[model samples]
Target: MLLAIILVTLIVLIMLRVPVAFSILGTGFLGLVLLGGLGHALPILETAPATAVRNSSLSAISLFMLMAQFMLMSGLLDSLFDAARSLVGRIPGGTGVASVGAGTAFAAVSGSSTAAAATLAQTSTKRMLSEGYQQTVASGLVASVGTLAAMIPPSIILVFYAITAEASVGDVLVAGFFPGLLIAIAMVATMYVGMAFQKGAVPAGQRSTWAEKWKSLWHASPLLFIFVAVVGSIFLGIATPTEAAALGALVALILVVARGRFTTQKFLVAVAETVKSTAMILAIVMAAHVLGHFLTETRTAPKLVQAIEDSAMPALLVMVLIAAFYVLLGFFMDQVAIIALTVPIVLPVVEELGYDAVWFGIFMILLAEVGMITPPMGLNVFVVSKSSGIPAVVVFRGAFPYVVVMLLMAMVFLLWPGLVMWVPNLMG
Candidate 1:
């Protein structure tokens, strides 16, 4: 009964526009106090923040964020996009497919989808619109592809999920690799096919000479190398995620220096942004641990799992409902908040049904990313709209096709499972 009321209060808080971290923290602390007394609630609130921040697994977040910042500062992201566009821009969808291609590459560098979305919005969206693509397609493509960052390697969300679920961070990161690449490939194919029916949007491009293509790729090689070093090292079991991230940040720093873009001010700005971003994530992490404590003390997850088990619903059906539930949560909540708030609750329930912890991490991220593009509170859509000067509704419409692509991909991997886990299996 108390758990139900806490959930109700949480919903009420969200509906009232309370900040998510606070909503979660307040409700969790309240529940702890009411159910187990202040003796229980007070200790968790006091310690969770410190404990969560000290997690060795989470150190990668700061390092990866720094790497992203350095890449952004060095203008490597622009070079990478141009390089991708040069390679794929001559295709039927031109900049649209190129955006997906570039987004996939950018995903390797910036774990934050908003960073990818804003970059593409400022660069790709304008070119796409000028190429005669519909505003919805143009804006939606950017918004959709930007979400690639969430599932691709070095992804902050994947790290958060792994830490919360007590899974191997490296395994979780590796698991997302194949599915993310498949989704990118699907988005590219989707773009080509979608453009086929758009009539006037398909324009023949003057294909670049091999020499020019090589030139663009050569210019962008540093970004590629960083991505490879980070991901390859992980896949080969040559480095921990934190070590790989540190290596990535170091290489990105050197790239900034080589480009003559390194200024003390710029470096400090990157550091500041990294700190700010990490701080926000850590606060939510703290709140999650506190809530996780409450849930654990009350044996909430065990009871819920037991009840669902006895209900005798097929495991697969329950899993589908859970996937839908995550998508529903995405519509209204931020992805970070959703992961922070629910992973503690849902992970155990799913694991109880024999789901792989690493697979669930990727599955959770993919579903949560739908919220990033869906209506009412789509974060990526708003970022694209603001940066591209397109209407949010149009961006939302634009993103719908990609959203469908993601959902279909989710179901595919869920059924096959191996498609999502083979790379991790290889790593093992």
Candidate 2:
């Protein structure tokens, strides 16, 4: 009953606009006090933040964030869009196709959905809009593709999930690659189909000559190399995610300097942004650790698992239920907050069902990402709308089809878990 009350309080706090970290911390500490008295709760409240930050793997968040920030300041994201456009902009729905292509590439370096969407929206949305593409279609396609960042390697969310679930981070990162590609291809195909049926949905581009395409590829090569080094070295076991992130950051700094755009101010700006993002992420981790402690003390995970098992439902059915829970919560809550709050509860249940942790990590991220493009609170939709100067409803309308594409991809991953596990298995 105490657990039920505390859970209700947590939900109310979140609904009342309290920050997730504080919501978790307050509810958890209160629960701990109620269950164990003040003496037990006091030490935890005192030590939780330090213990959480002491996690070595957590350092990867900062390093990767630095790598992404430096890469962004270097102006490589624009080059990525241009390169993809040069290669594919002549096809029907070429601009939309190029958005997916560039989003995938930029996701490799930026490791952020918001950054990828903002960059493309700022640089490509206006041009695509000018090219006779429907505003909703163009905005939706760009917003949807930005979600690739969540599942692609170097993903911040995957890193946090692996840590929370006690899974191998490297394997989790590797597991996302194929599923990410599959979704990317699906988005591109959906774009093609949409363009096919609608007249003047997308205006054709002047096809670039082979020579021009080659030049564009050459311009994008440096960032591509950094991406490969960061992700490749991790897959090959040459470096930890943190070490590879440092290496990537260093290479990005060098490239920025080489491109004659590096400045002390720009470097400082990157560092500042990295610090801000890292701090926010770590705060949430600390709060989650506290809540996890409360959950452990109450045997909440075991009970939940037992309750589900007692129902005698199929494992796949249980998974679908969990996915539905995530999607429903995602409509109203931030994805990161949803992951932080629920992973502690759901992960043990997932493991109890004989699912691979890495596969579930990828699956969970895809589900969370679907919420990112869906209505009422879609962050990507708002970001694209603001960046593209389109109405949010227009962007939301555009994003609706892609949301279906994501849901379909989620089903595919569930049906064939090996598609997510294959690359990670190969790494072993």
For candidate 2, write residues 281-304 as lDDT tens digits. Answer: 888888888888899999999999
lDDT of 1 by residue, 367-411 (tens): 989999998789999999999889899899878888999999999
Clashes of 2: 0
- Evaluate all candidate structures by whole-model CA lDDT and list the values in order: 0.87, 0.87
Candidate 2 residues lying further than 4 Å off, grouped into runs, are none
Q: Write down the worst ten-residue block by lDDT for model 2.
A: 197-206
TM-score against truth, every candidate: 0.97, 0.98
Q: For model 2, what is the alpha-carbon lDDT of residue 222?
A: 90
